[model samples]
Target: MGGTVVRQEILGGVAVLTLSNPPVNALGHGLRAAIDSALEAALANDSVRAVVLAAEGKVFVGGADISEFGTPPRAPLLPDVLDRLDGAGKPVVAAIYGAALGGGLELALACHARVVGPKAKLGLPEVKLGLIPGAGGTQRLPRLVGPESAFAMMLSGEPVDAKKAVAMGLADALETGDLVEAARTHALKLAEGGAPVRVRDRGERLDPATRAGFETKATEAVKKAPGQPNVAALADVVRAGFDLPFEEAVKTERTRFLALVDDPRSKALRYAFFAERETARVPGLSKETPRREIASAAVIGAGTMGGGIALCFANAGIPVTVIETEQEALDRGLARMRATYASSVKRGSLSEAAMEERLGRITGAVGLDNAAQADIVVEAAFEEMGIKETIFSALSRIAKPGAILATNTSYLDIDRIADATDRPGDVLGLHFFSPANVMRLVEVVRAARTAPDALATGNDLARRLGKLPVTVGVCFGFVGNRMLARRSAAGERLLLAGALPHEVDAAVTEFGFRMGPFAMSDLAGLDIGWRTRKATGGKAPVADALCEAGRLGQKTGKGFYLYPEGARTGSRDPEVEALIERTSAEHGITRRSFSPDEIVARLMLPMVNEGARILEEGIAARPGDIDTIWLNGYNWPAWRGGPMHWADSLGLAAVAADLDRFAEESGDETLRPAPLLARLAQEGKRFSDWGGR
Candidate 1:
């Protein structure tokens, strides 16, 4: 009690050490030292045959103090402290009531037994920071939970609930009532010849077949990981645990973990992790900025993106008004929402009543003024600038005076739309992903004159909507789409040089994207880009011609791939290839075959170079802002970190050189290297090296 630790005596043979950190109970230096002293004191007491480890907060250990990241690490990490506890001759039972994450889970794993409350969650999420578990987690976890389970937990960094934890053998049992009393009783039973000696001696409970299956899964992961190193390294660490003795495996795990602590990917990922925390910290955005409490939200468009956005607000339990100009469109959005809810129900993730309750909160309307009193009116209208401007003008007049006027304009200038309103400061861009509700990213674009309170409200709104909000300066396309434009242009050139859409998309997807550009384009519908081009009066070339030919993508039954009914992806369309060839000849472009190496260089170099442009232009606050946008919004693979992280791994000099070669080969000046890229390349530095503040 003297130093943030509550120590108590139970019955004959049980003593308790409860960590008393506030909030999430992040295990810090003082807490660790107290835990060490408490363990030692309990070990010395003759009456204490077993100990119950618990926490006196909303959660158990939420993990290491994230605030200490990128600084000199503290002594005695959770793994070391837990090892000391395990070294004691008596049994240690960990009683977990809330989330036990990262180092928290490692500590629980070190205990001889574990009891978790029904609402408890456990996970090893070090990989999310581009790091493997440093504290014997890789070794001890595989021994207890088997290889496949451990591998997935480490790689994906997702938490498992109490039921799932018990089923997976991560938890010994569920603590039904009092966690402390249950833990103390379990400890006493173990002390009086009840449970096993320690986790180290419980190899008999592990199945050899499980190990074999895990090895196979690891092999599959390696096969999936082409150029990436971390996924394969995770698989290797899991393999070491299965092949080597326990102590030897622990040593191997430590070596791999330490080596990756300062790896380029880790540094970038850790930087991104901290930067995300700092995003909510604006100098002017203190507690003083008056925030309007928005109890309900509304979406004016009921298309794919609109329905998803509506779902996001509804999922957060905010009543949403989904307004469309047509009753038919409103009905379609309702049907899509029902299908989405039904899918969740089918996955056993939703109850029928719960789904109905969520749906019940959403009201479908067919008039622009239907949700006139909404706290926030989000217009996800057609990409046409005129349509969006019209919507904004009407929303400003129809919606309540203080209501936030948000435009879901992806690439169009947000400032121009804000000009349509009398109160420009209250208008901003809330660019969500294609299916706004499903994707986790929500880019909050700040126009030059946007009021500080409005910006704060936008950020708060995104949080309330259950999305990650990244601030980006107003520009054509904002941050995420702006970088994507560069990637798209590079890919288009690759197609002109005889690299098929499949080839380019496959190269990037194989490099770690969930889907290649063409596949995504097909899924999003090619007509989207065609419409954007027509509105902007820009030459779409291939996209315009495809749309003119009625090749509007999956809905039209033909796109880059020709689809049959019920098939999400289409087979290769030779007709599209012929179209490409015809366009190339019409433009007087000499066709040449491009290798995958050439394809990658052509596609990625421009995006990397444009990212530098974005950073210098202040469209994105930091390199990590871009990373977070792509990671959440664009489905960039987490294991590869992000584009900027990948750029750091590629080395700035090498990327600049690749851009030079691309410009020379493609004969296009947009491939000309960015000044920032050139400077960073000359200095042999990473984008992360240029830190903020």
Candidate 2:
């Protein structure tokens, strides 16, 4: 006989309530109602002296169903259900396995006792969604594990394992074998002994000094993230717990949580959460699409990019061979890799043994012959087409059949590169961002003739390397850099028109970017872009002047800004300002002061326009894919939900009007509103509302 989502059974007078919702068993309305009903039944049954709450899935309730957020209220809300579970007349034990996160952890906290398997993880991660724990997590967690521990866990949104959970008193015990049975026994023992223990009744007090220390740390964390409303809200909610009564603190947390749930930052963060997951679902690729096993990998070139790419493989426990053209270059690459690991170890981010193990997985050689054993070969050579073609041609001859060949090209023609190889079907782009080991994004560029399995393999490899992979069609700069070029172009014009480097950067940073374009240029070195511009015969007069004057950024202690010796931060440079003014006069540009708002509009609108073009041109499969690339790769603020979503939130009509204004002001046709953007604006539509072409 079929049963409700929550099934109750009597085992030695202990009522075992098993949450039977499929998949993640999220606590939605129906499941919440079922759980309440089961609890009521267990409470009334004379034979049931205690209760054991278990879940019939790999995870013991993966928290609230995110889809249910912002929807109409349902009876027996999560907090109420948790209260009912906590206040049950009989003792209750939570048998936690897999993950107990957010509402899941709150549910466990509500129980009299929590028994977790060794592999289980517990955390309250609502802060990541721009909301605090609404259902008493802020108040109760501090009661279990003091404010300091609770503050760090909630702020970072990272889960603690069963051992840590027990150590912190989040879980009463670690039952590695048969969690449900052990939990039932524990509950029965509790029932036989006395009345149930209540988490709410445990009033753990914190010393004034310890409370002040936690408050200071939380304040600093909030200060570090300037414009993120959730950070400040989290700090406020956590601090409130210290001063307010238990029930009063919970009420405050609930009020703050609900307010944040309706907040723009929260909405954006939630959108980004879903958008990231949506990016993985390629339109045409079926679940059955064959993905090749990548047991061994090879990376060509031993430059910075190549070394970082090699580290990605090694970190994933995949053996990698790095091929360089010369023995000297090979040694230099190995040295760079070792230095990076040593630095990480010194920072306490990595253990010496772990670093050594990762280092051991990597081997360096001087030729393509070493690539024969690799299941996947990633060419991280120079961006020149000739060099890439030569490497691909050599790889085609050397690599084993069925081996997936990938290029770590940022902005190059993948089809042309594939044409150089014999197995065009096996060729695709695995465009890892600079410092590949650190950056989470990897643009999986799908070439014209690339096979489905090749694309699948690239996606699989990216996941293994802990990278967010966004599949895109071949194009100049693909999705991210293509749109970035538009933003950079606008920033350059802003520099010449009147704004100095600091002004432009300040405007963008104030708008929620980590760094301004010019400031970032200084750190990356202006010579890099200057070289690319020179090769393409591109003109950015101020940038060219800076390069010509031997002010090539931090390396030279000057570029758009000046830096002192041994200092990373740059200061305003009058020489750069003079050069910009002179360049503006030479170009017959009338200089005018730009407000921060104007600067942001001019810089960002062009990117939105370019993104519209990218979507219309089929370069990106969906608007969300474009957003994903910007969020992960380009440092787009998560709370803004990426440029496309941000534009949608701003209203497409207003964005289109801004684009038109920018085009007219700058006399740059490239800033003209794309036809798709204009149409959507006219129709009162949005990029997020696009149903996909």
Query: Could you say which candidate leads in lDDT?
Result: 2
Model 2 misplaced stretches (Cα beyond 4 Å): 1-3
User: Once superposed on the true structure, which residue ranges of model 1 sit more than 4 Å away at CA?
Assistant: 1-42, 45-60, 64-81, 95-99, 113-121, 134-156, 160-189, 194-196, 208-245, 248-252, 259-272, 275-278, 564-575, 657-670, 691-693
lDDT of 2 by residue, 1-693 (tens): 115798888998888889888898888888888888888888999988899999887899888888888899888888888888888879999999889889988988999999999889899888778778889888788778888888999999999999999998888899978888999999988888788878877765455666877888898998887767788887887788767777788888888888888999888887887788888898679789999989999999999999999999999999999999899999999999999999999999999999999999999999899999899999998878899999999999999999999999888899999999989999999999988999999999999999999898899889999999999999988999889888888888888888889998999898899999998999999988887777677888888888998988899888888898848889987777888899999889899999999999889988999999999988998888998899899898888989999899889999988888877877778777899999999999999777767
Tell me each candidate's TM-score: 0.85, 0.97
lDDT tens string, model 1, 30-107?
777788888888889988889999987768889877666556767766667877877777889999999999888888
Name the Cα RMSD for model 1: 4.2
lDDT of each: 0.81, 0.89
lDDT of 1: 0.81
Q: Write out the backbone clash pairs for model 2.
A: none
Q: Cα lDDT for residue 173, model 2?
A: 91
Decoy 2 TM-score against native? 0.97
